[model samples]
Target: MASRVVRGGHALTEYLNAAKAAEPLYGDIQKHVLEAALRPSGRRQDVLHPSEMVKPDWCHLAAFHRLRLEVEPAEKRRTTFTRENIFQEGHETHTKWQRWLTEMGRLAGDWHCAVCDGYFWHDTTPAHCHECGAPSRCLTYAEVPLNAHPLRIGGTADGYSPQDAALIEIKTLGLGSLRYERPEYLERYTVPTDVGPVPDLTRLWRDFRRPLPSAVRQTQLYMYLASHFEDLPVDRTIFLYDFKSTQETKSFVVTYDESFSGPLIEAAAAIVDCVATDIAPRCNINSGSGCPSCLEFEEQK
Candidate 1:
């Protein structure tokens, strides 16, 4: 039996189109959402983010240009509304899952007690505890900030569970298909284009068994930082991929591998050196690709 998956956007468009006929406020609501999408939020940190480091060769030149922009501010390209909406959706998905875990008492986050010189579990830091009283100083977890300050690298991991000795990372992916659907043998599945079936360049649906390389790298870095910063047994990570359309999930267990992060940190060091010396590294990508860094570097001269 051949597994069948269908793009979810088309069906959603049809339903939305029909619903708009009855909903008078739909246009206004959409306008509000679009405005929210366009609004820029959060100050950009110049440090190397785990998410940004997964690109080819760390896309070091682009990163260098970005860090430079912080000091020499300039107008930079903005991502499209569609892309922004995708990010917003991913954030919402993470919140939804984490909240569910907390509600079910399965999500345990670690907190440090300065007085006892120990760690405990709770959603947030408490003002006082039995051992630690009078303005208890503590560090709480969940979206816990982890960093290698000397290396200029930092990021927040999704969640941590002391009980399982595992770190949690949530990912949201577009519904590339109805995962449960299967087609009879010899039945048509995908549109036959002149080139071929829609290019599954990432093999997203055709081979959905494994996590994306970028996601794995991001998680590996988080695990590495968690183990070092908190002394937690972050030898393993649980990656939960939630499909946006159906909210269906697929989970994978990734064990810590020094082989994955050693090169990442090494790359970060190279980029840091380039920035410190005020010398731009040679572009790892072709200038013909219109890399912003290449253009910015040329303009700086």
Candidate 2:
């Protein structure tokens, strides 16, 4: 039997609920943010691939990406008048963020492509396409239909390089000591029942023990399929940094195999089909969390 500590309505449960509720709203925010980021280019005719088109469930992921880029120099200091800066404030808290981004941009200047299209390097070498003149295009998103499932699988990858023929997934971590826990760690951690007060380390450890939480892992899997099926050599890397101590953690790398892509695509298609058919998808949050738009609809019912 599952332990009481592993029961539903635990902190993990609440966290998943909040994540679910934020999904649609985050998608909206992402659409706005990405549009803002791309607006200065004035490339209206630059068509979005099916996966690149923002979906109703993409808000959270988009917000995270926006926050990450907003802290990068090329994006932060590009120009206050740019669409990326439309909602940014020049306040004290943001000032440091802006400065950090600027400094990082300077340090990373040589790594960027001269073509100015939006491709960035994930390796020590610069990303360039000899045949295309454009720095390798990363498949930011892709929409593909799977036969096993009736719905279209919408997916977004971190980055891709046609030059090197590589697919890269980027993960960022903010200031903290790093430790990789095994699956057994889930059995060791306990979820507290009382809500009065929680220890910081306990909370962190509990969070660490939580699995990839099905939905998030599935999304990543979908992204993998979207990029890998196109014949890109897939890779994953983590960028771990400690904000408080300004220390860097380990940068781990992994390569993906093509055999995994087809199954993931099928899974993504199944998920999309479930969503389209009004069937409650087997996600962390079946009822949809506190997304304001979703909430309004719920209230009406």
Candidate 3:
């Protein structure tokens, strides 16, 4: 764990420029990421392993090392981007994200918070002051200190390092890009008439659900943790969108409280129950054309 010290102060703009120049090296990591992407929803252990990544789905295996996988149904696969192409295009935002962090390594001096316009002692992000709560960060550096922290992820002890993470988001637990609710045929068939038309929830989510269900669960868990054991100050996550690249990133916000216990596992059980009862076995995937929505409905013809 080495400290990133910038001379006199870090010239944020300069390092940012240099990182832009070094984009290709970052692009190479996308291949490894694509490996993770294709196999959505797995235990983090094998997914993050170096040997498992040897037979990369694409050449030379390069791209940011980590990403939330975006799985699409095999039937719906229409994108022509090679594994490399898609990952590279998709991973563009991640590259920028890492570069932003690497520049922090070059950070040098004390800076002011634009939001509260005051100084705080704690490192890392959320840039808030313990004294006065102000939601300010991603600060403009004036010889700032780039407090680099390791990304502690769940489902595995191993993940990208701080240096490598300066090139990636750190940890992500996600399945296919489009989260589906497997259709419920038995329930619809067994039940009688007007219990309200069992709606097609799929059509409702035609657009990308940019927000993660993980976040929702995180929110609920934080609520439970705060109520039961300690008062944890949960910060709402934010999205950073790039109009130029048409890329977007869900910014990382990590926090903890005085009661330095391990992550709350209790929240996971509730989430699993909800998924099993409400989401799993529910199907939303359907033909957008005027055709009948369900394969079952079409088959009974």
List residue ranges in candidate 3 displaced over 4 A: 1-84, 101-234, 242-264, 267-301
- lDDT order of candidates, top first: 1, 2, 3
Q: Which ten residues in a row have the lowest lDDT in candidate 2?
A: 139-148
lDDT on C-alpha atoms for all candidate structures: 0.64, 0.34, 0.31
lDDT of 1 by residue, 11-42 (tens): 33433443465565764454445445434546
Residue lDDT tens for model 3, 13-131: 33243345457765435333433333334434212222222211311111111211212112221222143354454455444543464356522223446666676433243344444
Worst 10 residues of 1 by lDDT: 177-186
Model 2, residue 258: C-alpha shift (Å): 8.1
How many clashes (backbone N, Cα, C below 3 Å) per candidate?
Answer: 0, 11, 21
Clashing pairs in 1: none
> Candidate 2 residues 1-301, lDDT tens each?
7322212333334334434545788644544444344334432221112332223343322222222223211221122122233235212223343234333431121133335434433323334533335643421222122122233333444334333343333332221113232333433443455774322444343354222223234334544544544433435422222222222223233444445446444544554444445453332223345444233333543
Stretch of 10 with least lDDT, candidate 3: 58-67
Cα lDDT over the full model 1: 0.64
Model 3 clash tally?
Answer: 21
Q: Output the better candidate (2/3) by lDDT.
A: 2
Q: Cα lDDT for residue 104, model 3?
A: 63
Q: What TM-score does candidate 3 reach?
A: 0.25
